[model samples]
Target: MKKIISWAIIIYVLYCIGMAWYLFSFADSSIPAEWKGTTADPATFLTPREQVLSEQYSQWKNFLFFVSVPYDWLAYLAVLWLGVAKALQTWSEKATKSFVVQAAFYVFWLSIIMSVLTLPFDFISYRISRAYGVSTQSVFSWMRDETTDFLVNTVMLFLLVVVLYGLIRRFEKRWWLYAWMVSVPFTIFFMFIQPVVIDPLYNNFYPLKDKVLEAKILALAEKADIPSDHVFEVNMSEKTNALNAYVTGIGSHARIVLWDTTLQRLQEKEVLFIMAHEMGHYVMKHVYWGVASYIVLTFAGLFVAGRVMNWLIRRWGEYFHLHKISALASLPLFLLVISVLNFSVSPVVNMVSRYEEHAADEYAIKLTKDADAAISSFQKLTKEGLNQVNPPIIVKIFRYTHPSILERIVFLERIKRGD
Candidate 1:
């Protein structure tokens, strides 16, 4: 029975891979005639070496996409099935009489094991980035970032588990409802603090040094009615060569951040378009909508996951050492179920994200009246990131949160023609 199930899963993984390849292999080769002599044409701008490098990087990214989730599922299953989780449960319980302490201990050990499992792939990804000149971070700095990321994520998970299990013990059947209620405020709090507390941990940030450019960006914000604030910049050149800017945080905590790399790489006009695009996100209320969508999804997912977890515990409690839904051993089962649910909604999330990003592009163009700068900025961004002009359909569906550079550039050109 187990063999049959394993074979079925293997077959399904292959089917999905095949479908992704099918979608990618048929990439739209047709470029509109108007874009022929422009930077919008990949061939016009990309050197032969750049084209080869981008293609190679794209393939590596797609390979990782194919393997990442299945690898995670397998890693978690191994910990569960090989009795590591059960042993941790036993040890954590023996270590403390406090249920909360046990939960924390279990979470810590589970995170360590998961990190170990993920490290090889993570290192592979890092090494590949270095090879492609995408990341300039030193090995020590990269390792430091990884450790900090793991610790931060583990602490968050531990807190969430404490809340989840405490509610389960108290409410039992209605735990999901309470969890959702708790999560809404918790999510907002995290976002509010992230830009202030969490962001500074990874990189140094300060007020933008270019006073003249800062004035322009601030004026643009005023025009957009997003409230005036200081524009900030982060030291990004220490880690990567990628150029990016975004509006992060909520309420008074909100600020626009530019990667120092962006300032160095782009012209002043191009930088304005990028910053204007980030402001568009605020003007369009993408952040609020995103938070609302996450809240809605979690409510439904939690209810469904609770049902699935309860069913699994009822059926195979003793077999898997999961005698109760609240048992520390069952965290893996809960996570596995929740992960599957997340995958189910991944496309919808990406779809909304893409729409918001495309809207932001148009908004930036209209606000700045610099279709040329937007086009050039996007083209430079693609080159810096080594992103393909147009990814495969499957990649677009699963990975892209913004319209393809090809589409974005073409749209800008169309508007330029009308102008």
Candidate 2:
């Protein structure tokens, strides 16, 4: 017991050290002064009031960044520490003789407990977004969304848990390999269906309504040689005023979506640039590469988890209230390792994402040949999103999937200048 508690404390201490390290790393990280031009600097993108709001929003986002990872780690830890994991396992067994039912039962309760434990961090984020005039959701509506989210997550988790534990029972030594083998297809299927199945549960999606704009976007797609019928738009203005557009799904299911907020706020040219950027993802086969990356990360993560789970159980099985790594009670420990692993690898993932986004941006500019439109579109994005033009290095590494707004706009500004 003492050993387990000691290790937990040690892990948390190391997490604290990592948080500090990220801050220090950000301090040392710097971008080129030349990127900040005399006429069209990133800082010049925001007005005085917007600068204040952006700074405030950045501070809150950074605070969330520091706590969110730890919150996930501690949720798993709390379940294990408080005996909820063992209790839930026992209850699931007592409730059903069937293995599938037991898996579903256990996963459902475990997910709920973790959600309840971690709800505050998410609630804080919502409240922060609301306070900043970024979220239009009411408290009840927000809670409904949260509930819908966890229920969906629980169902997906139940499926994965059944496969994982079933593999463990059948081939204890090679369960990780088998589980990952299953996951590659499972992940692809999920990605393929998400735009059609899971996404619609949250918001309405339909063809972009404006015929003139849709025709222009389809022309842009044809110019890029992207096979598409029509542009899709989601009712984002119903939720928030933030502007966003992206490519989702894979292959035939693949389509570009623009937010109605974006369409309403930007000019026709700016909107086309946004759609062109999304088309670039399809043109470059980023979805396939992204899936490949996810599969590789899962393979490595599962392998490490298998090794670590066995070591911990071997050393302190009794302390953990479990006799073997395959026991359902050991799940929290397994997930704890995975949570830490994912957090540790996130910077590398985000780095790749930033690169992809940059490539897409370049593709969009080339296809549109409208650097002025691209620059102004980004500036508008920065304003509506309350995005800090020059965020610290820590944010650049962990939170940002796209290059910073300042970086994108400045790059396009250079293109406009022929520099």
Candidate 3:
């Protein structure tokens, strides 16, 4: 029975991988030209100086996309973890017999090494952003932010590993089930705390502080039926020239946050349009839906990983110095499997996200009744952010969380025409 179940899982994994490839290779990039009717082309919308910078930024981003898998999956996680696991095992051998303590120790060392290994890529990306006039932070400030991120992630990684390994030891066959169950609350807790706790570590967030604009936003929030006590402005201009506004957290924690750069770059109407879009996300319950989707994906990935890890350990246990799936040393192998599975599903996951974003765009237009503001906002953001208006289908399917700016503007124009 166990053999049959394992084989069935292997087949399902192969099927999912194949489906992912098909989605990436064959997804359509072009929407109906009717939707794009009479809208200004984003490709040629920028000033000459801005165009040059935009091209450079796009090229840098494209380069990063190509190397992401190799750097993150191959070098940082797989190959690094192989040797790191053995070294950690040696270090932890005499230090403790408690599994949770030993797992935490291994996680701490792995987190540090992973951060170091990935720092060069991160540095280069920051340099490119600065060269293109997108980033405003000094090197010292950037390093400080990076250090904070590393520490936060390290602590989270330690807790997760301890709980994960504990589950593995307690229930050999059903560890994945227990882990998935815990992740429901675990994920929500992070979401709930992120606005109040994690965000302040990097940037200061203050009430919008513009009385007239705040009143306008509050009015719009009332129209949308969302909470309106406060809208936040993040100190993003201190770090980047990009424009953004988002709604995050849940219940009392949920509120609007706009980047200071957004305030500087966009007009009042445009900012209101952006806020309306965020309100769309809130009213539509994208946050809750996103969490539910995560739970489903996490459950599926964990189940598959659990099944395959058992078989993998049997075959290559001694070679990797892993005696069992529950062993701390086996973490790298399990991570490698889960990473591959997650990458495979990225296109499908992103497809759903794009749909939600499109829905938000439609909702914003409906609620605001200001098609012009919505169109202007998308164009300004596309130009300022160096967005590729017409990227290849594969890139859109695999990478885009929002619909392309061109697609969005086109859609709003259609709505304007009563299409």
Candidate 4:
């Protein structure tokens, strides 16, 4: 068991290194030419929007701001390793009865430590957003957001740890089956409660008012054959300047949410394109498939984790200052398992999501022949969000959930050319 765990750890670490290398290599080679633009001066590259945002939050103090990016990255990696190691050690012991008790302690302690470590960057990000007129919240508001996030995360962590430990204890041989059984209920519960219960605590949501716009949106849904009852608008502008639209829930519970920021800035045609794109997700049944994929991946992860957890506990348990096999101590093991799964399958997942996005974009273009409107909307979105127009292929494969702006523009241009 000890040998198995050591091998697993070594293999996992090697896999992570390999993934990082692959990502960096791809970024260097596959970055699109159109996305790379030269500036007459370095300052010419800084968009007015970026400048305003930077100036606004410049007052916020960041202790770690002085640290180089590479150092920050190393610090993050170290924290993740420590947290995971501590968690796995606690979970591998036979003495622990209640994973919840263990996980709570682990989450509480780790969150505080991580929060302190991340404070400088967090404050800088908040201040930057505020400076750009993208964020409405004051410092108090930022603190409140953090507090709420901490509480929610703690609860979720406790639940997940308890459930995972229970599965490993009872169904060690069939951990994957147990995990799948647990996930179905949890996913359904999350879907049902998230919009009405969880979201309301974070941001205000008022029913959309424009009767003309409402009718137009509803008509698009009807044309797409999506139920009218599922169409809704949210006043997300109060929270952030970012624009977004998403399709949530499944079947009867499925609904659409469009941010007020999207509506406020975009023309009617642009809004329609966005709506059509989201509706495409629902129409294509991507949400159901995505959840199903997660369940499969979760099961695979638990099976892999179960195979090597005992050995890890025996070897690294003392080093991480942990005793027993509880959920709390086993977090690092869990994270390592998850990271392996992600590293191995991320490109496949990205391919799936990108395909859906492209399909949605196609649907949007079909609904509105306003290629110019689509192009302008994408430009506005990328600019407002301070997104890179073109990112390295490795970054896209590893990090991006959506295609880059340049890719979207190229696709749209291709559609225009009937190629």
lDDT of each: 0.86, 0.83, 0.77, 0.66
Q: What pairs collide in candidate 2?
A: none
Off by over 4 Å in 4: 1-107, 131-136, 171-173, 321-328
What tens-digit string does per-residue lDDT give for candidate 3 at 206-315?
98878899899899999988767647988888888789988788778887899988888889889888988888899998988988899899999999999888887787
Ranking of all predicted structures according to lDDT, beginning with the best and ending with the worst: 1, 2, 3, 4
Model 1, 1-419: lDDT tens digits are 36744874797688667755654464553356876778688778789799878877887867676677777777776677677889999999999999989989999999999999989989999999999999999999999999999999999999999999899889988999999999999999988888889999899999888888888888888899877654689999999988898878887888788999999999989999999999899888788888889999999999999999889778866556677887778888888888889887888899999899999998998899998899889988988989888777767877888888998988898898895
lDDT of 2 by residue, 50-73 (tens): 777877786677767786788688
- Residue 155 lDDT, candidate 4, scale 0-100: 81
**Top-lDDT structure, candidate number:** 1
- Please, what are the lDDT tens digits per residue for candidate 4 over residues 10-89? 76566556545443343332234443442211123456656334322321211122232323333434544455545443
TM-score of each: 0.93, 0.92, 0.88, 0.76
Error of 2 at 157 (Å): 0.7
What value of lDDT does candidate 1 attain over all alpha carbons?
0.86
User: What's model 2's lDDT at 187?
Assistant: 95
